[model samples]
Target: MSERRTIAIAGGGIGGLIAALALARGGMRVLVYERAARFAPFGAGIQLSPNASRVLYAFGLGKALATAASEPEGLIVRRGRDAQELARGPLKGFMGQRYGAPYLILHRADLHTILRVATEKEIDIDIEMGTAVADFALHKNGVTVLTERDHQLEEHRVAALIGADGLRSTVRARMFGNDQPRPAERTAWRALVPADQLPPEFAANNVGLWLGHDAHLVHYPLRGGSVINVVAVVADAWQATWTGDGWNSPGDKDELAGRFSAWAPQVRDLIDSLPSVTRWALADRKPLRRWGEGAVTLLGDAAHPMLPFLAQGGGMAIEDAMTLGRCLVRGEDVAVALRKYERLRRYRTARVQREARRMDRIYHYSNPMAALRDMVMGARSGQKMIERYNWLYRHKS
Candidate 1:
């Protein structure tokens, strides 16, 4: 392949891998640099809204996803203190019928595997493990990328460079200068439990959300109903003291149980039954006015890290990959194409980011505000509740 037809991507996570598959299908040679020696099943469950599922199916991942993902029956919202049902929204068949795609809930690792396996099958994609994108320089011909591996450096010239690296992105820091991500002052504790270990109420084929004071809980079945993925978010003052390497740090089960002690018995029992748990501090950055310059840009968490309240983090990243691939394959100028991709994605992503932060506040309401929230939620029909997010679910890239 001509050097002018080659593109380099940093970070082989979901965004980078999906971008590789999309680019290769567009007849461009792709080089993916992943710092990890091997891919590990790290994160917990992720929800795939229709907007994201559309892109995955377009990339020909429908079969793999069908086998690995589960479409929940619906979503049930309840009060954490008394287990009072607030609202139940349609998901499984309703989502597909209305949005043209299904709402899927599955293990994050499974989706990563589906993307990785698809990328590996493409003849034009090459993955370099244990390598990181150290830096890059833009020249008249293209962008020259510097990659570091085991104290050694190598240079490769590609038509454009894409930074799909996560929160602490090296490529992003190099372009925009180093700055810390804003901490949300919240901690997320995650765990996976055997489906059989819990009572029948917890094993139902749907997503459960419990709202409380300064905390919220979300649980859903994963891995074809054999395991349940649980995530609890709570206000915490210990974020400043944490010195973990990455997001997945050991969590104290007792401490986690204590946080939910005042919750309903089912919720309390769910926490106590966990064999182990991992925790990560929740953080996000204000939307960037510009995501990239010249022939380089960012995708996924690297570009727009947001609070998980909206469940659109991975979905937005998937949309970015599809848009970037389409722009590059149009045979436009490399720098111009990148700018176009950013222009198309920046506004929508920023809105999602802002909305997620707003949801964070609503989910952890207290006293009068909590009561009002419940009353308003209860008045809306489940179908109307699902329809409220048509702008988010009906998107196509």
Candidate 2:
């Protein structure tokens, strides 16, 4: 019998988990190393548009997601100060029917749990929590992931190593030494509260985006509409030192509430309603010309991090996983497969990264520019509005 090749993945995040499942389905033996002691619930909610949802479904997660995620009726764009409707784009039936898959919004923990559970069920996969890769050594035949657990050095050999470790990836650091993430000069305050704590409008089954000067707010129901996930991103000074604390930095509720005090009462109330907030210093790296070196490569944010303005960070990572699984499963030369995967994804991911930056500017436009943005949004018909996102949602891996 031919020996089964093993693929090692660092950072068992959503992207890593998804990639593991995808590769296992393609008959590759897979191992995942996660630094967390357990796959605990962290972070806020996320949106899984059709492009990503379809990939998860392909991995046999349709029913799991159907129950854990809420399909929003549509995306409503509003003026942050007065809450005036700027544009409405359908999502639930419209996006699903149009794109052949539904657009889902769910708590990050819920989605993580779903992926974690699905990955655990795979026979060809193994997961090691509390294990962090210290570095990697690449060779012509395979790669070795080096780690130290309990004061002992451990080495893992695999046909390829995927650095899904996210923004501050150790694998990426080994490949390209001393590359740091560039702050987008913004901060995000995220919180999830019970739906009943919010007013009916805010608790509605839709994705609501309130845009203002140098700031924006997004909220939607999650876990079958029992809880509402809210995120407030604003242009702020980089208060926290660029330590290892990339995201999940502590935030003060008073400071967050005060930031939105000038907005409409309804918008302001949501910020005040949170018991506390988790602040994340928004940052990203410039798109790399290549993703990996030899038998090792990068994935997700480790390859191309971007602003969340486009809400496609997760989607892009999910897309990368699917393409990667396909390329590796083709049984081509390991180097060729890794290079092929990078070629297939580099342009699209870079484009998304650039578009996300563009959105950051547009969403934070002030005075005349903001007014002009509202005018343009209001002018686009509902269908036309959806059409703008078609290129994003209709994508299939």
Please give each candidate's TM-score.
0.99, 0.96
Q: Best candidate, lDDT-wise?
A: 1
- Per-residue lDDT for 105 in model 1? 94
What C-alpha lDDT values do all the predictions have? 0.94, 0.87
Report the lDDT tens digits of candidate 1 across residue range 182-233.
Answer: 8998899999999999998788999999998889999999998999999999
| Error of model 2, residue 321, in angstroms | 0.9
Error in Å for residue 226 of model 1: 0.4
Estimate, for each residue in 68-147, the C-alpha lDDT of model 2 and write its tens digit.
88788888999888888888888889877899998889888888899889887899999988889898888767887797
Model 1, global lDDT: 0.94
Query: Quick one: RMSD of model 2?
Result: 1.5
Among all windows of 10 consecutive residues in model 2, the one with the lowest summed lDDT is 237-246
Give the top-scoring candidate (TM-score): 1
Determine the backbone clash count of candidate 1.
0
Those runs of model 2 whose alpha carbons end farther than 4 Å from true positions after fitting are: 1-4, 239-246
